[model samples]
Target chain A: MSEFDLIGRYFAALGPERSDVVLGVGDDCALLEIPAGQTLAVSIDTLASGVHFFADCDPEHIGHKSLAVGLSDLAAMGAEPAWATLALTLPESDENWIRAFATGFGRLASAHGMRLVGGDTTRGPLSVAVQVHGLVPTGAAIRRSGARPGEAIFVSGTLGDAGLALRRKLAGEPVAPELWHRLECPEPRVALGRHLRGIASAMIDLSDGLAGDLGHILAASAVGAELELERLPLTSWVAEVVAATDDWSLPLASGDDYELCFCVPPAHIPVVERLSETLGLTLTQVGWIRSDAGLDVRRPDGGQLRMPARGYDHFPAANDGAD
Target chain B: MSEFDLIGRYFAALGPERSDVVLGVGDDCALLEIPAGQTLAVSIDTLASGVHFFADCDPEHIGHKSLAVGLSDLAAMGAEPAWATLALTLPESDENWIRAFATGFGRLASAHGMRLVGGDTTRGPLSVAVQVHGLVPTGAAIRRSGARPGEAIFVSGTLGDAGLALRRKLAGEPVAPELWHRLECPEPRVALGRHLRGIASAMIDLSDGLAGDLGHILAASAVGAELELERLPLTSWVAEVVAATDDWSLPLASGDDYELCFCVPPAHIPVVERLSETLGLTLTQVGWIRSDAGLDVRRPDGGQLRMPARGYDHFPAANDGAD
Candidate 1:
């Protein structure tokens, strides 16, 4: 099909004007009118083949994962998902691949109430870059600089599953289907982030490993952190599976978790509990914001735990890196 | 250097914040608040190496050209450029390339008063996609559907020079350095677009060749066109060059001419002339919108001009059923 016809058939399916979107997916440009008394939060993320994902991963999962990575940023700021634009580079224009990608991307977009407003498709090696925009009430966004010295550190959902699942996939192990699913599709904790907006002092999504990502919050706020290794919130199934293996480091330094981590004041403990129960989500208090400038881990026996502190660095792997 | 360190040193330099920019680059997300009574006009364009430019093109020009492409979209909507976000895909982390790119990008951005807001950098084959946001007063945007029959079709600047320059560069012709510069740095007419906000009925940027792009305005407005080929505004040098060439097809149908083509009512001709002189830009009447649905080009001898229609199509060349 011609490029225009292809776009009209496949891409036009991604958007149609909704009440909030003044214009969607057509013409020379897209028009949007932000609602009064609100701030627009914008973030962009790019995922490359063999860099952000495995070389043989499913195309549908890649589509879902690309949008999810950008959504995670919005979740971190407690913003309501609004609109998105995509830039897809492909080696060839495959009709089947385009249809499947649009379907997967459309599903996530509909779920999050995000309008796929515009994008560009071109011939190149496979990669997907998405820019997402969200809305938050005036001055109400939960920034990383808002954390205080005595605030309680919390994380949603289990950690290291995504990283561990990736390892299993790479090793070609006979793992359960759930492992593949976890490695393929990650759910960004958007509802939990919104619930924590008014209560949490600081927030961020765990794209890099939790140990590394938490450091971002600390550095941004110019504060420090104390993490309890025993309280790291590993799932029972994960614990059992790792007990049979010698290496458990993946769980601690695995990236692509898409989980929310935030700092909340001591006084809001009861309110946070209520929110967790209401959202039907697990919220584990794993650490505390420190007055000092370095991160330290405490063990179950109250001994200091030394961690090499490495995660997914965008550059080549080096031994001396911290997080 | 690691992606984190590279971002800290170079990517962060693109953003240090400025007036009219509520938030600049950095943080988990960038925040921007559109002015009250203004509508945000956004456009996205992706440029892939070997597709948009030659493999040996300078990194600095590539960065500048990428932004220019998106900015032209804003000019079509008669919107004032405000901010932009970039998504860069590279084959490897090259520090020198990144520095040169930032330098070129920063020069244009500073000159246009556009702030770099948010972006993503990833490892992949070379590609640069930018999304630009412009502010236009509500109800004042010049859309593609507003042209009425009998409106004068006008274009700013000479056509086909960029495409011709590219041919010259590809053939290693070293006539003048300015010709090569024009091929690499075709500036978007931002001031002209903003000034024409109340004057033009329908407007569009000519990136996809005059015939193909002007057809868009025709199709969207549900109208037709009659072009006077003799009236096409070409530089004296370009006219002489095309007259001697065996085929003037590339000059007519080749893409990458980032000039503004617009439709204005006959009553506004005096104002257009005044504005053209004031801005020191030559605005020439090229054609007229009609009630019929087919394009007709009138030659200088009052005969029909049958020109081959060619422009950049994303699908493989064979898909044109040269398949």
Candidate 2:
């Protein structure tokens, strides 16, 4: 089929029809309206097959994860997801694969009321690049550099269940469907992020694990952090995986959880409590920011827990990345 | 080097710094302020090595052309280029290669006062995805469906030089430096497109060759076109290639010419002429829109010139994408 035909069949109408999109798919460019007094939060991410995902994995999960990761970035900035443009590189024209991918993508995008405004489909080794645009009130974006020394560090949802799933699968062991689902379909904390716009002083998405990703917040804010290791949020599946693999690094330094890690000053903790109750999400306060300048992970008994040797780097890495 | 270090070394400061960017590369999402009374125009395109260009070719050109193509789409909408996000996937961390690539990308972006607000760099087979955001006055952006039956069709710049260069390279023949340069670095018609905002009824960027790309305009506007084949603007090199290769398809059906194809009402011709002179660029009138609903290419003797059998398709096609 022609490139245009493939685009029409799978991607012409994948998400909600937002009124903000003036000229959508099948245009030289998509024209959109950003309301006055709002800032545009834009993020671009690429998921390369074999590097980011296995080729044999379900295409639906690939589609879901691709948009999820970019939305996660927007969520980090307390932006409401608006529009996305996809540049999909395929090895060949496989209608079934494309359809499944679109289904997965459409479901999440529609749920967020985000629209697919533009796309380019081409032949190559499979890679998907998603650029998501979101909106936040002018000057109200939560940046990583805003955390203060006395702020309480909080992370939404369980840590590293996605990485734990991959580890179990790679070890040739039986994996729970729940664990695999977490690996495949991460929920971007869009609503909670927007609600925390004024309450959270700093925010980041947990893509590169809590220990490393939170370090970004510390480095940018020029503050230190002390994490209570026992308070690290976990699912039963993650606990089982950690006990079996005997590796704390999956929860500490591996990647792809897609959860929001943020800091709330002492006075805002009450507001966070009200938000957690309203949103019905597990908002765990695992640590606090300090005046000193380094990350310290503590044991329940108060000695420091040794951190991983390296963070998950996509290139030249000690981590296998399911290698 | 670590992923963070790689980003800082190569991409952190690769484009012009603009005041509109509230937060740039290091943030989870780039925060940009789009002015009130304006609309956002967005476009995304990907170029994969060995699919779009030779993998062994200069990375600098890859960087330049990647941004050029997306900018061409924005230009088609008569939008002012503002920001670009690069999602670069490389096979390895070759610092010199990345530095050269950044230099090429930086040059074009700075020339237009555009900034690199965000990026994702990861290990994979070489592919570059560029998403560009530009601005146009509310309801003033050009669309492909705006042409009327009596409008004159115009195209900017000489056509087919890029395709001819690729054809010669693939045919194992010596290619001119000028022609090869066209293949590597085609200029985007940003200024002319912005100038034509109120004047041009319809517009498209010629990424695919004249005959095929022009067909998109005809199809969208639901009108016919009659082209005076002799009036097609061409460099002497293109005429030489046509004579030597005896392949009209290079000029008519291949891809990668970044020229703007547009329609102007007869009354606006004087304005176009004035702008052309003021800008010191070639703007050729090649055809006129008709009430009928198909395209006709008339030879100098008033006979029809039989068009090529196929237009370029990125997948399942007769044309080698220089394949």
lDDT of 1: 0.80
- How well is each residue in A117-189 modelled by candidate 1, as lDDT tens digits? 8888888878888989888887888888888998999999888887777777678776577766766788878
Q: Please list all clashing residue pairs in model 2, or write none if there are none.
A: none
True contacts kept of each: 0.73, 0.85
User: In candidate 2 chain B, what residue range of length 10 has the lowest lDDT sum?
Assistant: B314-323
lDDT of 2 by residue, B75-102 (tens): 9999999999999999988878888899
Question: Candidate 1: which stretches are off by over 4 Å?
Answer: A241-248, A306-311, A317-319, B306-310, B317-323
lDDT of 1 by residue, B1-323 (tens): 77776776877756335665555665678888887999888888889898898778888998789888888899899888888898888777889999988887877777777888888887778888898988889989888999999999999988878777877777888646666676788888888999998899999898877877887888889998898878888876568776786344444566788889999999998899999999999999999999987678787778886433334677755444211
